[model samples]
Target: MLRELPVALYCGAFAGMTSPLVAGSYSFIILAGLMSGIILAISKTSFHGFGGKLGTIAFGGVCCVSLIIYILN
Candidate 1:
């Protein structure tokens, strides 16, 4: 878990930055980080090292954050 932290944080940071471009706010950025961290944390335990899982988590993090933000607004 400790080893994965940097990678997870990097993914969260990437998700946080890109989410704002599509959704347009710091709120979305926060949501993206939260969702990305949670999703990646959950997935890590089950991951089989298939290609692109990290990217997929990043995308899903941004998308879910966008959706949640839209719903809240």
Candidate 2:
């Protein structure tokens, strides 16, 4: 996991930008970070070497959590 630490930090940074309106709780950011970590670990080859890959992953994680929060509400 040492090799993936930077990617994980980037993902966490994305999570930090989430708005209180969407998160609605502190756990939302944590959830997004965890989801992004899982995604980063599994999807290294899925996108190959495209630009914006990190952003795409971050977006996916945030969108996923937003969807979950929506459903739970």
Candidate 3:
């Protein structure tokens, strides 16, 4: 839990900072961060066999942001 705080913060900040320049989708940024955190937690607990935890979090964040932006536009 505590170990993933930095991951969450980094993902949130990255998404928040880039969302405006990317597409001005602030809501998607927040959603991306939350989704990434949830994914990290779940992956850490359930699927601890591949990609490690940080990789999973980062992948989840990027995928969520991309999906949201694609869907919105």
Best by TM-score: 2
Clashing pairs in 1: none
The global Cα lDDT (0 to 1) of model 1 is 0.79
State in Å the error of residue 16, model 2.
1.7
Name the regions of candidate 3 deviating beyond 4 angstroms.
Answer: 1-7, 14-23, 46-56
Supply candidate 2's per-residue lDDT for 10. 84
lDDT of 3 by residue, 1-73 (tens): 6886776687556545553555356666667677777766666566555545555575567677788668987
Ranking by TM-score: 2, 1, 3
Better of 1 and 2 by lDDT: 2
lDDT of 1 by residue, 7-71 (tens): 88888767865833596877777778789889987887776968877778888988887787679
Whole-model alpha-carbon lDDT for candidate 2? 0.82
Clash count list over all predictions: 0, 0, 0
Give the per-residue lDDT digits (tens) of candidate 2, residues 1-73: 7887887898778876788877777788899988877888888778776888887788888898888888997
Pairs of residues at least 3 apart in sequence or in different chains that clash in candidate 2 = none
